[model samples]
Target: MIDSRHRRARLGLVSVTALWGVTFSLNQVALHSMGAATLTFLRFLVASLFLLLGFGLRRSFWQGVNRAELLGGLLTGSLLFGGYLTQTEGQRFLSASLAGFLTGLSVVLVPLILLVLHRGLTRRQFGATLIAAVGLYLLARPQGHEGLLGIALLLACALFFALQLVAVEYYRITTAAVIRFTLFQMATVTALAALVAMAPGGGGLLPLHASQEAWATVAINGVGASALGFMAQTWSLRWLNSIEISVIYSLEPVFAALVALIALHQREGLAVWIGGIIVVVAMVLVSITPPGGATYPQESST
Candidate 1:
């Protein structure tokens, strides 16, 4: 039963990554209309509202709220917000290839952070991390000398993302409370994005002139990526560990490239294909290798 639950969680998390990949491609169309923060505000605003309407109707959902869920949601949301903020600002000074590679560095950060916290690590985990790191570099094919500021910002983005994964596992948020927990996260990002949108030189909450396509992209990402994607991620955490989750997330770029290739008719070089394959191998390694020690007990369904 444990193995079965883990397999299901892995599949669900992979689906979330694929959803993110689709949205990542769509963001190019939306960015032409508004700043990242402005787009973020609208996306999460839609997400929070959608969650409220979908689950708020249940009185039991309200009763599930507790201090742990609130605090867990706040920490995870803030870390998530930090990741977005850094990645968005970092792109200004770095190439997309470099930024993506750095963002995916969370896969490496997760293991390192776990080690620092006295968590167990197996040879398989180390090998997979090394392989995935190589795959990311080849895939990104970063050119030119990157600036210190951009590198720092994206690395910080990786750290925030890594910490958020750790926080999710540590919290052990229950399945029954996942909806409430995710709602808090959505609301927190929504509120923070609103603040960023209103800050000096923020370009305001709404764009001066947004295309219909842009608005439509926001709506799709809000429902599919932000709302459903996050809820699925939180629930999956009951079975998957922080390290496993981060490694699975490395598939995001591969999925993004595939989506672009299929939908946008974008072409990739041989190196891109090779790198993507290597990343997949890494994911398979994680799935098959037995963990070395107990981290957290898997939470059973309610």
Candidate 2:
């Protein structure tokens, strides 16, 4: 049997996934008042700072910081920042719950990316994909705030996020270095957001610099979502296969629903409850231990 430490790691991954789910409501709270770009910039800037602190906590975390890793970090950071920005922007028009649910569809997309990369998927993968898809339909309540456009944008966010995950797995960085790598990426993402903020759009929400609320959002999103979340993901993922981790993360929506109900005073109908169950069930069916490709986790698109 797996040791207690390994068991703890697996439990930690579930907890991390739960924390990640809790963050959905927090992000919605932040983005409600801030521009997507400005909020995205702040999140990364804060997450970058956290990353630096994290690096300082341990030696040799950056031992593998070579040119390839640097470039890869930059690329990953850019994609991640852009994907998050898009998701945040989408959230402006969408409900936090739906955004969380739909974006969590990355597990479906992860497997597809694996397939493209020559890693074949199993029957379980296909089954989970279908269940998650059905969950998507249920979560996509018609009366909600998010429309077709927002849905499409969130889906795109999911795609790019999946790419980043596959890339992270492919990069061959040690698990111990994941947070440092995340820091490097956050720095790159912050720089990119700064540059983008400069482009003729009137600062997006940069004018809210003095707004305590905006700054608070930045902290919660950056530290809570990016830095801390990344750490939790790594901590939990160490004990489980990527596939298992992905499946566990597929519960983000359910977690988000609970978070929303408690924190955001958000309500979900029977449809959402039923749909979420379908999605979770599908993930369980498809996420067995046989080891397959073509399925992945969608942490927030996240």
Candidate 3:
């Protein structure tokens, strides 16, 4: 039986996934008024400020940072920034559905990366991942051809996201304080994105003339998705393996479709309904599988 703790972790991850799903539509509105770089910078800036306020300015918070946390945050944060940047750039060239499908490829890439790290998933887990991938393809129904550069960028984004997932699992094991580690990671992403926004040839550093709606969307994404979502993910990594996490996150697009249907009155095709069912089935299979004798490692505390 799954323990209460594991169940709670699963619930937390589900909530995070839902928050992320909501961002799909919210970001569409926000991006209309600001460059991707500006949006990213503001999102992370809000998240970092919120974290700082909650954690406060303590000597240990700033001075006790170990090498592992610093290095891990830099690596993870960079990969995250790359993932978002490339995905945004790719979307400019590819259809929205196709770009989303390509981004979801990270679900497949995560297990592959873990295998290379000598942490292969169980056969059952692998099967579920394949099933989930198929569901994602159907749900996305990706069509049309894009420039090779855009395709390549989306593929790179998937790879970066996969690596970020593995890095989070590894770092949660090594870092002393998950909160501090998350804070540093958020700060790094904010700084990198801000630099890109302010670069010589880039659009201006700030969205000084952004609309109120854009600001509200940014605020929601920052506090809900970036701050709460990321921290919940980092904390949950201690209880769940990377493959499990990836499989669970595959439901994000499913949730997004639901949000669109209910909130925006957007209609989904038959393929989407079938795909949603398949993905949920995959999630059930993974969730019910016994944890014993699995090759994947689970670290309980940092």
Candidate 4:
């Protein structure tokens, strides 16, 4: 079971989760300050630089890369971007906490995707999913159904995130040695987002020069959150079960909610507090329980 490797991977997973948990608020700040497309571009562009320069220095950095591998990278990157695009668009209306919880719904959506694929899920995964669903409800109760648009976008993001997970799980490409391929995927996303950002009537293309805070946010996201966070996430996925990934990811909202309350001074209603507790409990169980009773690579290189 590669026990030593698995332990390191899990540690990486936790690190990734910690950073991502707070990113929901960070993302919201970025969306408000810059065009979504531009913000997205900068995140990946900076990440690409890190990956390229860091790995490029090593001999045979592209040793395992090929057109097919690049394509797989592109697919994974696209799915990731789709999740972000839906998420950013949804944020125009949704609270960051609500959106973060809804996005974590990918945990439930993934097993469902497996069911449709005829691969199906073990009873354990299904059971864990049901509990998570109840947690999701607590976190997502709407106000008289008036928040439908945001809900729909959140749901869409969840579904895409699930697809991304599945793609990464089955992807036969060298999960490591991904620097070149990751760059390809990042470039595609950046190009597409830039075009969309520039389109007339789109979120006005250029970045906001007036807000240096926004630039700082963008730099932080690119370096700390997106690039570094995702490298950990992808690496952890190599050793961890999807359930573990989901459990850790569930923390993103819990952490985001806390950050909002402590740092942003946001108030929470009773329902939010109750729901938050439920989600935290569920995440704790899911993390400790494991799927099929198992435990993720997870080096900085990923």
TM-scores, in order shown?
0.82, 0.83, 0.82, 0.83
**How do all the candidates rank in terms of lDDT, highest first?**
1, 3, 2, 4
Instruction: Give the per-residue lDDT digits (tens) of candidate 1, residues 1-302.
Output: 35888898899989988777676557766777888788888988999999999988888778856687788888888888888777766666654444555666676777777777976767887787789778767755643355557767877988998888777777764433677778888888889989998999876898869999889988997898888988887788787777668778877767766666677676656786677677667655644425564444467443
lDDT of 2 by residue, 1-302 (tens): 45686677677767767877776777777665666677778788888887787564666665645676667677777778767877877877766777777677676676667666876777667767877887778767664554767888888888877777666664433322456667767888788887776677726536544466667767777887787776665444444445556677788877888888888888877887787678767756665655343333222100
Candidate 2: regions farther than 4 A off: 53-64, 141-146, 173-176, 202-205, 209-211, 234-238, 291-302
RMSD of each: 3.5, 4.8, 3.6, 3.5
Clashes of each: 0, 3, 0, 2
* Cα lDDT, all candidates: 0.74, 0.69, 0.74, 0.67
How do the residues 1-302 of candidate 4 rate in per-residue lDDT, one tens digit apiece?
66887788777776776666676777777677676667777777777787778766776876755576677778978887888777877776767677666777776676567567865566655666667767667656743364567778888988888888777665532443434555665666666676777788566556656277667777787778777776665656657766567666766776767776666676767776676666556545534544454534243233
Better of 2 and 4 by lDDT: 2
Supply the TM-score for candidate 2: 0.83
Ranked by TM-score, the better of candidates 2 and 4 is: 4
State residue 114's C-alpha deviation in candidate 2, in Å: 1.9
Best-performing candidate as measured by TM-score: 4
Task: Write one digit per residue (lDDT tens) for candidate 3, span 1-302.
Answer: 45777788899999988877676666666667788888878888899898998884766667667798888988998998898778766655654434444565677777667566776577876787789778766754533355456667877987998899889888887664677877777888899998999997555567778888789978998899888888988888767777778777777766666665666565656775676577666655654436484434566444
Range of the 10 consecutive residues with the lowest summed lDDT in candidate 3: 287-296
Evaluated at residue 44, the lDDT of candidate 1 is: 87
